[model samples]
Target chain A: MLDKTTRVNLLYDHYGALLTEKQRSFVELHYLEDLSLGEIAIQFGVSRQAVHDHLRRAVDQLEQYEAVLGLVSRHMRRRAVKRQLAEVIAGLPVDDDQQRRLLELVGELCEDGNGTGGGDGDV
Target chain B: MLDKTTRVNLLYDHYGALLTEKQRSFVELHYLEDLSLGEIAIQFGVSRQAVHDHLRRAVDQLEQYEAVLGLVSRHMRRRAVKRQLAEVIAGLPVDDDQQRRLLELVGELCEDGNGTGGGDGDV
Candidate 1:
C-alpha cells in the first residue's frame, strides 16, 4: 500500500486547485514540504487545530473528487502499464543501439510529463 | 492553435473540481454535452444571464489555475511529445508485425488514459 503522504501528494497534483487556498496551502506544507501542523498554523496565522482541520478537509475533498472522477486512479494505472511496456521493449530482439534510441525517444516524451512516472505505491 | 472551446475543455478536464458544483455542471452541460444556454438555464432553473455568468467565472478560474500551475499546458505538450514518439516508433526498422504489436501495446497503455489523446487540431 502507498503511504498516506504519497497518495495525498498524487491527489494534490491532480486536484489541488479545487481546494480553497488555505486548504491547499496547509496540505502542501504538511505533506509535500513536510511541515508540521503547528508550523503551518504559524505561517497561516491560524491555530494548529484549524490547520489540522483544513488539511483533513482538503484530503477528504481530494478523495471525494477521486471517487467521482477516478482521474488519479486511471492515471496511475496508465503510468504502470506504460512502465511495463517499457520493460517489454527492453526484452525485444532489437539491438542495443536500436533499443537505446527507442528508450531515449520515450524519455524525451516523458520530459514534458507530469511527475506521474513512478509509483512507490498507491493508496 | 486550439480553439477556445478546446482549450477550455482541456482545462475543465484538469481542474473542474476546483470549481463550484454549479459551475462544473454548467460547463459540462454546455461544453461536453453541448447544451444550449437556454436549455441549461431551464435545467438548472436559473436565468440565462446567471448561467452565463457562472460559466464565464468558471472559465476565468480555470484560466487562473492554468496560469498559476500550467498543468493543462504541460499535459498538452506531454501528449504531443508522446504522439511524436509513437510516430517515431512507427518509423523504426522493426518488421511490420513488431511495429503493429508495439502500436497495440501503446494503445493498451492508453486504454485507461485520460481523453487527452488527440488535438483534432489546442486553444
Candidate 2:
C-alpha cells in the first residue's frame, strides 16, 4: 500500500478541483507545500486541532471520490500496461518500418495516456 | 457528438451507482427499459413532468461526474488505442512464440481495461 501522504497526493491530483476552496488550500499547503499542521493553523487563523480536523475531512473526501470514480487506479494500471507494451516492442527482432511504426505508436500511447489522465480538467 | 440516448447510457454505466434511488429508477425505466416518461410517472404515481425533471437532473449529474472525472472519455480512447495496437500486431511479419505472446497481452489489455472501467466497484 502507498503511504498516506503519497496516496492522498495521488487522490488530490485527480479530484482537487472538486474540493471547496478551503479544503483545496489546506491540502495544497499541508501536502504539496509541506506545511506543518501548526503552521497551516497559524496561516488560516484557526486552532491546530481545527486545522487537523479539516485536513482529515478533506483527505477522507478525496478517498471517497477515488472510491466512487476510480480514475487514479485506472490511470496507474493503464500506465503499467503501456510500459509492458514498450518492453515487448523493444524486444521484437524485426527492424523494419513496421517495427519503427510500432515503437512510435507506443510512444504516442504513453504520451496520450498521460495527456488524457494526468490532470483534473474536462477533455 | 454521441446521440443523447447513447451519451446518457454511457454516462449511466460509469456513474449510475452514485445517483439517488429515485434518479436511478427513473433513468433505468426510461432509458434502459424503454419506458416513456408518462409510463414511468404513472408507475411511480407522479406527474410526467416530475419524472422528466428527475431524469434531467440525474443525467446532468452524470454528465457533471464525467466532466470532472473524464472516465468515459478515457475509456473510449483506451479502446481505440487497443484496437490500433491489435491492428499493428496483426500486420507484423514475425510468426513466433513472441508474436503469440504479444497478441495475448493485447487481448488481456482489452479484457482488463473493460473489467476495470466498465462498472462501478471498489477495486
Candidate 3:
C-alpha cells in the first residue's frame, strides 16, 4: 500500500502539469496536501462527493496516460540500466575519475527525463 | 502536414493498443490502410460521419496522452542523444571494437524503448 501510493505520487509528479487546472488542484490537495474530501470540498466550494469525483477523474486520466505511454516506467527502467552500467563499469580497469564521470552522466539522464517530458515548446 | 502525419503515426504506434477497438480499427483503416472515409464507413457498417467521430475522438485521446506522457517525444530525444553519443564516441581514443560496442548499446536503447512500454504484465 505504501509503495502503491509512492508509485501513484511519482506518476502524478510526471503528469500533473498536463492535467486541467481543476483536476490538478484536486489531485494536489488530496494526494500531496493530504486533505480530506470534505476539507477539499470546503476549499473549492463544492460538496465532498464532488471533490471525490474530481479527484477520481483526475487520477483516472493520469493512469490512462501512463497505461499508453509508460513514461514513468520507462524512466524507471533507464535508471535501472544506468545502475547496471555503473556496476559493470566498476569492475573495469578505468580510473576513479572516469568512473565517477560516467555515474554522473547517468544521474543527469534521470533528471533530464522529467524536464524533456514537457516536449518541444519547452526546449 | 507531412511532418504532422508522421508525428501522429508515431504517436499511434506507441498508443494504438490502449485505444478502444472501434477507435483502433478506424485509425488503422483511415491512416495506415489509407482507405477513403466512405470505404471505412461501409466496411464498419456505419456512416462516414460516425467513423469520423470515432477517429477524431481517438486522435484526441492519443494527443492527450502524448501531451502528458510524451513517450514518443522522449524516444525521439533518446535517439537524438544516441546519435550525438555516436558522434562523440567516434572521436574517442578507444579501440574500434569498443567504439562499435558502445554505439551498438545505444542502438539497442532506442529499440528497447517500445518494448518495456507494455510494462509489468509484459515483463
> Rank by DockQ, descending?
2, 1, 3
Q: Estimate the TM-score of every prediction.
A: 0.68, 0.80, 0.68
> lDDT, candidate 2, residue B106?
58
A18 in model 3: Cα distance from truth in Å?
5.1
lDDT of 1: 0.70
2 or 3, greater by DockQ: 2
DockQ of each: 0.21, 0.34, 0.18
lDDT of 1 by residue, A75-120 (tens): 6766676687688788777788878776775554444223222222
Give the docking tier of candidate 2: acceptable
Writing each residue's lDDT as its tens digit, candidate 2 over B1-123 gives 888888888788777766766787898889888999999988999999999999999998888767766657866775787679778887777777877887776554544222223334332
Model 3 alpha-carbon drift over 4 Å, by segment: A34-42, A45-57, A87-123, B1-4, B47-53, B95-123
**Candidate 2 Cα misplacement greater than 4 A, ranges:** A96-123, B96-100, B107-123
Interface Cα RMSD of candidate 2: 5.0
User: Which candidate gets the maximum DockQ versus the true structure?
Assistant: 2
Model 3 residue A82 CA deviation (Å) reads 1.9
For each candidate, the alpha-carbon lDDT, in order, equals 0.70, 0.72, 0.65
Candidate 3 clashes between residue pairs 3 or more apart in a chain or in different chains: none
Which interface RMSD values do the candidates have, in the order shown?
8.9, 5.0, 6.3
lDDT of 3 at B56: 87
Give model 3's TM-score for chain A to 2 decimal places: 0.80
TM-score of 2: 0.80
